[model samples]
Target chain A: QQQVKQSPQSLIVQKGGISIINCAYENTAFDYFPWYQQFPGKGPALLIAIRPDVSEKKEGRFTISFNKSAKQFSLHIMDSQPGDSATYFCAASSRNTDKLIFGTGTRLQVFP
Target chain B: DAGVTQSPTHLIKTRGQHVTLRCSPISGHKSVSWYQQVLGQGPQFIFQYYEKEERGRGNFPDRFSARQFPNYSSELNVNALLLGDSALYLCASSPSFGEELFFGEGSRLTVL
Candidate 1:
């Protein structure tokens, strides 16, 4: 029940295109969902996050659309750039837990 | 301000051996969490420490252990290392429970 499943093991898009990665969680206790970006050999960096109380949250060109009833959420990178190319992971946690449950990563490649 | 920092960027161990990885959290942050990321996969939680006290632990075996210092730094030790233990060990810090996590570059452990 702690699993957060992510899909599109890999994605390819052109510069200026939109890149999206999806994730679903099985635990209903999860209230916070966050997305992370990881470059090769580096630890994951917090990109954007949202709470279940809200339907969406945006930070710069990155946006997260969350569906509380569906137990799913997604990250959308607008105007995707090569610099944004990296492995993206979606994670979830609740105020009751100190640990964040992460999803299988999605490798995104934005081509010029 | 310095972010979370990890030591011995890489190490190699053999079966039946033991290994230790270290981490120093961001100044003023009292919560630290450790995770293991195998190649091409998301990080799996290992342990979490808050205020020098263990607050959470993942589904790892008894061979895995960790401790936190008064300074909020931490160490993860794994005994009887197996080849499956070869992976990147990541350390993340947060100001409090259920907060955003900032990570270090991570230590790469190779068990042969």
Candidate 2:
């Protein structure tokens, strides 16, 4: 029940293409959802996040689309660049809990 | 302002040995959390500390324990470490509970 399932274990996109990663969770108690980007030999870094109250949120070229009824969320990268090649993770957590359940992760490779 | 910092960026230990990993959260941040990431997998929550008190713990075994100091620095201790315990240990910090999290580079542990 604590798991956050993510899809497309790996992805390949060309520069200027669109990249998308999807995630779903079973725990309805999760009120907070965040996406993290991780690079080789480094820790995961916060990329973008969204809550159930809003259907979507955008930051620069990154956007997060959230669906409350489906218990699913996705991260989209516009005009994907080689610099965007990294592992992306979707995470969920509840205010009542101190832990954030993370997805398996998606390795995104943006080719030039 | 420095980001979260972890000690012993890399280490090796034999099975049944004990090991201690340390983390110093960002200055003025009071909330600290620990996570374990096996290669190619998303991070799994280990423990969370706020105001020097343990606020939450994950499904990890009792062999994994942690404590926070007055300075808000934290330590993760593992006893009878097994080969399965090897992974990247990450420390994240936030201003308070239910907020944005910043993660450090992480400490890589390899058990023999």
Clashes of each: 0, 0
Structure candidate 1, residue pairs in collision: none
Question: What RMSD does each model have against the real structure?
Answer: 0.8, 0.8
All candidates: TM-score of chain A: 0.97, 0.97
Once superposed on the true structure, which residue ranges of model 2 sit more than 4 Å away at CA?
Answer: none
Residues A17-108, candidate 2: write the lDDT tens digits. 99999999999999999999999999999999887999999999999999999999999999999999999999999985558899999999
lDDT of 1 by residue, B1-112 (tens): 8999999999988899999899999999999999999998999999999988899999999999999998999999999999999999999999997889999999999998
True lDDT of residue B65, candidate 2: 96
> TM-score for each prediction?
0.98, 0.98
- Worst lDDT run of 10 residues, candidate 2 chain B, spans B93-102
